[model samples]
Target: MVLMQAEKTAIGSICFLAGPFTLLENALVLGVIAATATLRRRPTYLFIASIALADVFASCFFTTSFLDFHLFRQSDGPTAYLFKLGGVTMAFTSSVGSLLLTALDRYLCIHQASSYKVLLTRRRALLCLLILWSVTIFISFLPLMGWRCPTGLIPPCSRLFPYVNHGYLACWTSFTLVLLTLILCAYALILLKAHRHETSMTSLQGAAGTGHARMRMDIRLARTFGLILLILVGCWLPALSFMLADVFVILTHTQQRAFAFCSTLCLVNSAVNPLLYALRCRELRVALLQLLQRLCVIGRCKKTTQDLPPGIHFTEEISCTAITEHEIPTNGTMQLHSVSEMVNN
Candidate 1:
């Protein structure tokens, strides 16, 4: 009892401090993605946005629960655990499931390059996201709906900690393993095709222009997705393994402490996702840079309107003036120039 309580406090403290920061990061990523028209239009980023949204909610739920406990010294009651469990499961599942859809989308793009757009239309993508959320919500609330918690206990509340049900654990583990395997297989085939195409490009005559561009894009995408997969596996594998073990093998106090560690480690995935997107994605990097520029413009009042870039503002209105000049010099040479500038206070 003493060790378990200690584990919760120690682990919970770390997560409590980290939660707000994670929330901010994911929120910024989502903001950037939403603000940029180019990113929001892409089918892949649609899934990325879904993942970011899930993480944001996860951070909110987790942070709120932790604040209740840390600030007010609240007990581990049913309500608190319900919020925590719902948030964690939904976030984790959505993040992983988003990756699965992304991998499958990339595979289709590679294999059916001509028909990819026709197949995965915006409507279809939206439908997929809707289904993903529906399934995730259902699975997350199963325990609350009478799967594990016994009947006739006080005013109806289940004990906190080790919410794992053996039947649910088996089903969850199987689903996750299968989905991850599919993601791996899809990426493997993508890498293989990229390698072959790159080799063939090397042998082609005068293929440097488009061929090199395509090869670079393919290789960069593969690497980005590969990094995402690695992060996902590293973050979640320990938690999944321990969850599986808890089904058959009874864990000692030490093992339970380790489970606490694993659980926190998994939450790290949500924290690091925005960082990964910012670093690995060129489009997102550009959007982040623009966002920062806008912030800087809003902060400093000394910069002249002429110095600022076009259309960078917070709540300020940008009024543009366009003037065209046509001049005839002594040499009878005619010149025309057009200038457009935004007038700002």
Candidate 2:
């Protein structure tokens, strides 16, 4: 019993430390995205920023769970119920909902390429985010009405009751399963469209070059989303599976620890997203680099021009190439001949 208590304490301590770290890392990512005018203007980045915000909330909520239970030594009363029902559930749901929104955003980009801008306007995106928050808040509070511990099971915070446990489990599992399915289907359609575009581009002419450029862009975006999906599943599925099992079969002491470990893994997902952006998105990478430079972390006196967003560099490159190709005379003799003829005339 003593050993078991010690193990639980160690785990709580680890989670407590991890919570602040996760919040800091995600906050920095948000700061970089918000500080960069280029990133803030892009519609897709709005969804990314929303995810970061959710992550920040998640870190705060999860951290509070550990602190309330361990360091504060709070009994399983109102505070415990608040953290369990309010903090963890709400945070997890919000993060999952944000990912669904992101997948939907990507789908709209691929589905309505001609008028994606019109379809996914800034107004609509913000509205979607607001809806997610409203819906999650509604669901998270449902248990407060009656789905909580029964009067008899009160005090000591009985999380093991069939009614309360299954109530939470059913809601989460259904939401998770539905979102997981939709995301999978969305990515499937995205992949199919990209493949078709690739095949059609092979037969075209000047447009083929641009088509290929679009294809590369699509592939890169798809890869990043795919990684997000994989990470989400890898982290949450095992823990969710265990939760579902707990509904039918009682978990042993060892199984309880496994559940805790898996739950911690799910929280870790919130932190990884910023790292993914830094790794996969060139614009984000450059923005982060510029941010670090300004902070004197890189020890560089001059800012690097190569760290500009791709669109800016693309325009500059095209303008420079146009000038070089049309404005400058390639042959010195021809230039001299034309000038001399004009002078003689």
Candidate 3:
């Protein structure tokens, strides 16, 4: 029992440290997207912005409630506890829903390259976001609205066990599983289509000129989608499995510890997302660097543009020129310019 308590203490410390980092990471992504007009107009970055925003909320609420429940052990009444859990649930759910939207956007980009713009306009994307938040808010707050355990329940009533309804967990888990399945299927089709495109290009243009460019673009996109798919499964599957199990059977002490660890693993996803989804994109990266530079200037830092790092200075110049001249190539898609094309190689 002492050992178990020590382990929990270590995990709680780690969670406390990770919370602020995740919040800053997502907040930077959101700031970059909001400050960059070029990114805001595109559907992909808009979805990314939604994900970042959700993560910002997730990090804040999850860290607060999780620390309170595990470490502080303070007794905020059942109403306050339920509200915190609902906020955390709603934030994470919105993050997942935004991820699904991003996957669909990528699929449409590859599948309907020509008419993708018409299919998913900025207005439609905003509407979809609005609808997603509305549905998730309603679903997440059901516990607060009378789906919780009865008031007469014993001391364990504060934790998720007797506090939140089991039926709600089951339903939410099922819904999340369905979303994951759809995301997986979407990425699968995207990879298949990219493969066919590659094969066709190789057969038709063997050892040829512009075909190599197209091939490289397709390959890069495939790699990005593959990485996203891998991370999503790695981060979410274990937690969902544990949640499903908890819905049916009571967890032993060890099992509860494992579940808590798995839940923390889910929060790690939010921290890594800016690296995978936002910073990996050349345009967004350039914009983020520029945003940082502007912040440095406002802070009265003595660093000059020449003092910037090698590749960043060059890339920032190129990005600024491209934005100013409106010469960023899209290759008939609505997405931002690829890194290769952005560098004008």
Model 3, range 217-330, lDDT digits (tens) per residue? 777877887888888889999889887887766666677777778888778888888888788889998998899877865555334335644553243433332242244454
lDDT of 1 by residue, 207-321 (tens): 6686767778777867877887798788878877877776666666677657657767656888887777544678888888998877785555445544766774423222221
Please provide, for model 2 over 292-318, each residue's C-alpha lDDT reduced to its tens digit, 9 standing for 90 to 100: 766673333124335533343232322
Candidates sorted by TM-score, best first? 3, 1, 2
Residue 218 C-alpha lDDT in model 2: 76
* Minimal lDDT window, size 10, model 2: 312-321
**Per-prediction backbone clash count:** 0, 0, 0
TM-score of each: 0.74, 0.72, 0.80
* Root-mean-square deviation per candidate: 7.6, 11.8, 11.3
lDDT of the structure predicted as candidate 2 = 0.69
Question: How accurate locally, in lDDT, is each candidate?
Answer: 0.69, 0.69, 0.80
Model 1, residue 246: C-alpha shift (Å): 0.5
Least accurate 10 contiguous residues by lDDT in model 3: 152-161
> Who is ahead in TM-score, 1 or 2?
1
Q: Pick the candidate with the highest lDDT.
A: 3
Show where candidate 3 strays beyond 4 Å: 1-3, 151-160, 208-223, 298-345
